[model samples]
Target: MNRFRPVRTMVAAGTVLAAAGTAHSAWNSTALRTPPPDPPPVTEYVSLLMPVRNEAGRVGPALRSLLAQEHLPRAEVIVLDDQSTDDTGDVVRRLCGPYRHARVVRGTAPKPGSPGKAHACHQLASLARGSVLVFVDADVVLASHAVASSVALLRSTGLDLVSPFPRQAAEGPANRLVQPLLQWSWLTALPLRRAEASPRPALSAANGQFLVVDATALYGCGGFAAVTDEVLEDMALIRALKRAGGQGGIVDGSRIARCRMYDGWRDLREGYGKSLWTAFGSGGGAAAVCALLVWAYVVPPLAALRGSRWGAAGYVAAVTGRTLTARRTGGRCWPDALAHPVSVGLLVALTARSWLGHRRSTLTWKGRPLRGWH
Candidate 1:
């Protein structure tokens, strides 16, 4: 055990160094992503398309934020409130009725067996009128510059799609301890900047909470109806964009948008379980999440608990690595990374739940029962 300590420290340090370097690429390309393309010759029409189910509580604030965007355009806010049983209709009616650009289309029932959101988004897209269409979830509140930020990137880069990794708002013990996974998974696992940089469109990953698209491109590629059955429409859309040789990437969503992803631990567990299964899939789900936890969080802390100077130094570096990354990215809860063991344990539980969900085939979400795609 003593002999192996140095080797473990070196390997862990290398991992930290690697992640730090890879994540740093976003900062390098920031200026390029904000190119000065003289604000298009015309107003260049854009519409904000929001698809909601029972998000009455969240939709009001989200709509307000969308309306407040700075220099956005002659934009229209189209909220496709998917036939909710809640006060969703009244909520949209009050917020959208007064404003000319803000309008709500009450969604018709999905074809007997279709998922609610996919069908709702399809309806939203069909009704929207703009050169550029943005699909923002009702729960996500955009920062004043979010629309401009994504549009600028799209204009500068000429990509068919632009997805923002949402800024997740959380409180309480469970929320604080586990939210970093949402940020780090994309940063460490994917070569995100490289994907966005290249025009080849082979690289992929998109956050549906806030996704922007060229209207012609969206329809030319078959539209939201194309992914009406996908359990993870965001990732599915990313794949579709790639197969059609379109561009996709993540940005500093925290600066321009935020979302209370869940009410509490139970919602987080179930919601993420469903999402994790879609994102990570079954066979790789359990083992891969476990390995990441062990490597990134568990093992380093274990070395620190040994109560030796070298162990302390290694663990301190681990914490520093995570903290620095979090500080720069604005997407993760850095303090939560300190709750390594508990978070990893819960993550494993969720991973297990996801596997069980896939098998049982009753992984319901937002009032729709899930179907096993893989």
Candidate 2:
């Protein structure tokens, strides 16, 4: 067992190194370039849809940014107020008042089996009249060219759906440690170009923060109605699209949008806890992923502290992958990458918390009980 230990270390180090290489390749291949300052005219009518609930404090800037979008020949902005206890609806109405093309829609409570966000999105999609549907989250602020550039990429790539992952804005310690992992995990683990080309649902990924989809393909896939109960509805939507013979994948939207997902540590913990259980499909899958992450990222650092050269190499490789992902995704790179192991640990803890919440029937997001947890 002692002799085989060195071989195990070597294999583990190699896996980490391979992940680093994958991250490098994904960065080069998956980046979304800014469209030309003066691009061809877009004839397709685009509808920018947003669903807001308890976002009074943050929705203003995001809505303002959406309304300020330029270069769309024909466009409409539709915001659905999803029964917020706060002034979310009023705030959106005030911001949208001056824009004749933009309007606010009153949303009803979700059906028993539906998730709030998905239900809200389903309603917004039904109201959309555009040939293209761009869903922007209330917390996501877009650049003036965000809509135009994303539309250009969608048409140019011929993909049915494209998720431009916004640059995550992290402020607290918890945020800084875990936020970068959002992009890094997929960038290091998934083959970006292959995921786009493949029809396999398991190869798909998406971010709802700023997603662009062809309306026809979306309707064909059953739209948000197909993913009404999913906690991770963005991924579910993309998978549904692929299963329906449509192509969809993610892109580096850091240049075009930014989002701060949580207010602080407490908010971050609850936010992740609400949905992380569903991220892996099952508790067993969650355990496997946690174990794999620990072995690939956490174990090497511990062994390196014990003077193992192979372990040191693995640690370096892990950090290199994180650094590459950060550089590509506009995240904080330097000291944050060094804390990759901590991030993995926190993720595991969050996954565990998510499962526990489900078991106890305590899982909720924004004060609503999560549906379909069983």
Candidate 3:
């Protein structure tokens, strides 16, 4: 056998695995079905909870969208103002004045060991009177039937929690390169149906931007307090819920909601730097994941430029998988998918910056220092 044959075989196998995963995700992925014209009456009460900090400029659309929700007669909207330096509280109060079902609560400083967002969520949970809770980010704008459709899916699937991932709205070049990776990461790497059926924490996936959870299971699993110090609290919360014998997973929510998470490259870098270090559990795991990404994505494209057949095949498979994921998740395909290797490189760079910040105790989000860095 040629000395480099094994290396080529490994590259080919990795590409094939990625292709298989993309195909499986596409085949089994579930979308939040549009509500029927006369949707069955919802009997369970729902609490639409929002946590905001320095979101004054953008919270209006999100609050408006929540207030305009249809088929949720027995629901209440609650916004927690997490001590924003901006007029977020005033903005929410003004918007809520016209809707009796909506109200704003001022949040206190988070106790030691608790992140601000988690503290706000915990406080909101305490005040909720509903059997179901839908946690939405201030940046996300929901469709009129988002809540109704999500609840229907939850009931139909018998899941304790479900994340309806919004269609990421990417603006500039930086966003075009990175935003698609949000859904593509899980879509290509995870088996969604299997994740829902399995209780293993490692098999779980979620997006907190528009998460719906059965309140009973949430409390039973310790709620946000269980993940108080977690940087990636959404994933941690799902893992905790699963560990408590509850089931949950992600679904396509592109048609029902959308969010633009970052403004540009600088904003995106800061947004990711604070939490990416904890994404893979530890420093070693982060390194391993980055290495695998480079090997499976970046290397093949480079070798393809040098006329290697296996390399060309691997690069094609990577692009094909990206295109499929984008099409499935309502992201920009075509030229964006062609830059898959560049996306992986940026992700690796962000991961490194995240680790550096973690080690130097420099991570922060929205003006609050991240605790539990040791």
Better of 2 and 3 by TM-score: 3
The C-alpha local distance difference test score for the whole of candidate 2 amounts to: 0.86
Q: How many clashes (backbone N, Cα, C below 3 Å) per candidate?
A: 1, 0, 0
Task: Give all TM-scores, in the order shown.
Answer: 0.85, 0.94, 0.95
Ranking by TM-score: 3, 2, 1
lDDT per residue, candidate 2, 161-228, as tens digits? 88988999999899999998898888877777778868786788999988999999999989999988
Taken over the whole model, the C-alpha lDDT of each candidate is 0.70, 0.86, 0.86
| Stronger candidate by lDDT (1 vs 3) | 3
Off by over 4 Å in 3: 1-10, 30-38, 112-114
Q: Write the per-residue lDDT of candidate 1 for residues 1-374, one digit (tens) a residue.
A: 89976767755664564345434534433422332223443267788888888887778888888877666657888888787889988888888877887887888887543556778888888998889888998889987777877787777677778786776777777776677656655655556667764544335677889988888778876777888877677777667666666666676666678888887898887787666666554576557657766665556566667654444554555555445546545645355656645666677778778777877776777776667455
lDDT accuracy of residue 90 in candidate 3: 94
